[model samples]
Target: MIDIVYILNQIDGVLYFPILIIVMAVAGLYFTLKTRGVQIRLFVESLRILFEPSGDESSVSSLQAMLVSTASRVGTGNIIGVSTAICLGGPGAVFWMWLMCIIGASSAFIESTLAQIFKRMDNDGNFYGGPAYYIEQGLKKPKIAALFCICLIATYALGFNLLCSYNLQSTFMDYSFYNPATTPMIIGAILAIITGYCLLGGGKRIIKVTNTIVPLMGVSYVIVSLIVILVNYYNIPAMFALIFQNAFDFQSIFAGFAGSCIVYGIKRGLFSNEAGVGSAPNASASATVSHPAKQGLVQTLSVYIDTLLLCTATALMCLSTGVARNAAVSGAPYVQSAIGSVFGTAGPIFITVAMVLFAFTTLLGNLYYVDNALIYLNRKNKPSKRFMNIFYVAAAFIVFIGAIIPMDAAWAMADITMGLMTLINLPACVSLGRIAVDCLKDYEKQKKEGKDPIFDATDIDIDTKMLDTWY
Candidate 1:
């Protein structure tokens, strides 16, 4: 019997190992150089712009948009994903994850800036855009844009959401009363019901939920990680040494590049921060900023927050506890075990609660992107209210289905779909990247003149006729 799930994993591995990694690295480096390290040079500026008011109650603020994106970025990937990386790829994977964030932030800025540059507005005074809008408007390729939108819908609505559901349910396996079959179905029903309520209420409801949950959950998780670090202060120095030592083992890296620490770190890091993968731009395009670069910079900071802060917090909590790292304890169990080493019975309970919050917010956040993609696909003849309601019910059923699937199968499905999305998005970003670069220059020139930067599409050579929001 040929196991289909095993084939999926193998295919995902081949897709990512050298080809995806090389393209992602080159694209990140290209953006980093083109913007002259915008991620670092404008770090403080990004922070300043993050809290700026939207100036319209109907429009999302920079902070709210960031929270919405962060809700998706900082999900189970920050918890179970990090644990899985360390377990399979060694502690050194943490170092590579950090490295990817630094490079990938620049890509995040470029894609998001382009998203805002070409965003669209509906009659209801709401904003929506992503790779699809930018590709069609900027690249003048509506067909490719449609393809990208289809991939986006599949990646977020079906693939990633399912993985999140599975990861959330996996946390309960340690409890004494857990039944592998019944517990997953029960938890899935509860999660699906809650998610369906939010989805049917539409985009505003989704934003409200993520905005409230992201900040509270992030702060609480960071505080808990701090406690874990303090308890294992004695082992901190050794942990750093181990991470670096394993990170730079060239011989091991060459021998098994696909299964190496670098590969796993990059894979999970991209999953967590989602910088170059092109997901954040959906939320970035929603913000009502005076300048596109402002939201771009804000999104760059979001990458740091997701990976550098939240993901690192998870990695350190696990490593600092000196927990055993191997396939047998990967995913949620590994994180639970690591924390349990420090807090005993209370640790697993805390992780379960955290997973619920993280995965739930992620589910909503992912659906938010799905809404954007659906709108783009249906721009010709807008989807009916009844159609959207049916879609919501169908989406909830997918969540239930996700909870019952095998873990490897769920993750492989997400990885392959996400990889496809990245392949489509990266090229479009590179082609339209010059516009983003020009936007940054315009922004900086205004800053130098001691004035607030406001975008004028005419300032750049791009066709402004298609930029509905800018006018």
Candidate 2:
């Protein structure tokens, strides 16, 4: 298990920093320039359209789509993933993480816009599109499209579900009364039961559940962290200073983690926010909207919400309590320790309960994306609802199996699969980014004319008959 983790980390280290990080960073910069920094100029426009009703009666609203992606993005990554970054990379990692999200928002805008542009409607009248859809439609490479579908299912649906399930189990194991031998299986079974029920109900129930739970869970964590921060108000300035100082001088302050500060920081940041990772595009494509750029703008904001707000809150809450300095500390235990210091034993209790809800929601979001991937794989262009049902049950058992593994092994599997996914996905989003830029320009042009922006496939010179949603 240790060897597997080491090898995965080495591969991830190479791809993440020197390769995908640079690729995504350059793509982000290119898109930012092309779109004239739409993430900033249109930040308000993003929020404005969030509540606008999805004119299509069958599909979910834009806000619900955002929440669905957030449901996936805002899980253990915001809490456990942030804590791990701080522990492995030091407080300085926070700075790099925040930078990643801010820049990656542009990349998010690009990919999600492409998702909207290439979206297709099935015979059953449901909308579906993502990196896979765009890869086939724009790049005209069915093989690459199939490759991306396999990667998405492996990473987002299978890999993340297992990794997070292990963490959720680990949190429960921290207590004495829990049977170390049997407890993990028990937790896994319970999660499987709860999640299976929703999976059987189909996509809308999954979206409905996330929309209801994402806001409430996210706000609840923030409210508690705010209370913790308020009590440690004086330490806030010192914490901020430490973050900035160490970000640059981590080598002088912490002996071994010199270069790792930026690498681990960027890695965790990307993992947490998932801005350019192509995961959110699946959920972003699910929304019924007036224009593709509107969903793009909304998704751009989702990155900020994941890293800037939820992730920052977790970091401050951990660092402010002074628990994050311990190198051995990581994952939910770190966040739990920091909050426990302020709120008594309620810390573990709070996070354990929170993890159950947060991780469960993440699993549901994963299954939703998996459903889309399966659809994309269908050669017949017909509903694979029965096959999806079989996969869902198989995944529930996999979750139980994953819960039994050591946390290190779980993370190792997730990182390796996720690395391969980014390698395949970043190129598509980058090559096709110009489409997103043009879409944004068109939307702004219409808005300036005092008209509600509506996307017309014909206007873009793309094949109109291919895109059922736009027509």
Candidate 3:
């Protein structure tokens, strides 16, 4: 497993060092300009739509879909991942992470808006679309779409959920409440059962669970962070100063942590908000909206919530408590120590409970992508619900097994696969982004006229047939 992880990391270095970095950065910059800075311009309006109800009862609400994606985005990455970033890269990583999310929001807008524009009806009479659907249908590249979906499955299904389960198991086992030996299996089974409950109940059931759990977890985390921040209010300015000053310390002054800061921070940031990784669009596409850009804006807001709100909270907790200064910071321990500084033993327990809530919901959310991916992968023979049930059970079992064992190798593999998916999706977004641009223009035109914007497929010159709902 260690050998495999080593190999995967090597692969990741080759792919990302020059290629993925340039594409992701340049495309993010391109779209931010191409779209007239929609994320910034529409920030207020986007928030309003976020709280607004899903207009059609038949389709998932925009907020529910956003939460589903947020469920995945705001996971252990925000907590343990932040700890690792700071430990490895120094406080400056937080600044780079924030930068990634800000620019990546534009990338998210392009993919999600395209997903909405190209969404089609499944045989089950449910809405489904994503990077694969849009790449094949909108970009007219079936072979690339097929390749992309396979990587998506590898990244999310075979890799991420399993890692989430393993980490969840470890988080539970770390505490006094659960016996270390038996706790992992017990937690894994419990996760499987709960996940099966959502999966068997179908998409709406998944939506219901995410809509309920994700917000509660997010709000609770924010409240906890606020308490911690206020407790250490005097340290706030200096902590931020460390962040900004070290952010560009590419010299001997920062010593060992110089270049590492940017690398880890950007890596963790990409892992956290996942704005351009193409997963958010899967959730965004499920929404039934008058205009495709509505969901795009909602997803863009997710980037801000994930990084600016959640990740920053985690960083603040670590930095303010001085826990981040540890030379070998890793995983839940760093966060637990930070919380412990302010709240004592309650910190670890709070984090343990939060991990279960955040990671388990993420497990469910990752499954949603595979569920939609299965639909795109199996167009000829529409999957019966029974088949999907079997698939879900297998998925749960895989997570269970991964949880019961070590998952570091699988985690590394997932990083590589997820990176590939992002690279593939970014190019597609760059190409098909014009559709989103057109949709944005149409939506803005309607808004300026004092009208509730509604999307017409023809407005973007996309075949109405590709967008089954728009007619």
Q: Model 2 over residues 346-395: C-alpha lDDT tens digits?
A: 87898887887788778877777777777778872646678767887888
Cα distance off (Å), candidate 1, residue 123? 1.8
What lDDT is reached at residue 217 by model 1? 72
Any runs in candidate 3 off by more than 4 Å, and if so which? 122-126, 172-214, 252-259, 324-327, 384-390, 404-410, 461-471
> What is the Cα-based lDDT of residue 427 in candidate 3?
91
Best by TM-score: 1
lDDT of 3 at 234: 91
Off by over 4 Å in 2: 178-182, 196-214, 250-259, 380-386, 461-466, 469-471
Kindly provide the TM-score of model 1 when superposed on the true structure, using C-alpha atoms: 0.95
- TM-scores for every candidate against the unseen true structure: 0.95, 0.92, 0.89
Encode model 1's per-residue lDDT on 1-471: one tens digit a residue.
Answer: 999899999999998977899989999999999999999998999999998998998789999888778878988999999998999888999999999999999999999999899888777888878888888888889999999889888988899989999999999989999998699999999989888887888457665765676678779889989899899999999999999999999899889988889999999999889887889998888899999999999999899998999999999998999987899888999889888888899999989988988888888778878877887889734688999899989889989989999988998898888999999999899999999999999999999999999989999777778788665
Error of 2 at 471 (Å): 5.3
Among these predictions, the greatest lDDT belongs to 1
| lDDT on C-alpha atoms for all candidate structures | 0.90, 0.81, 0.80
Candidate 3, clashing residue pairs?
89-261
Candidates sorted by TM-score, best first? 1, 2, 3
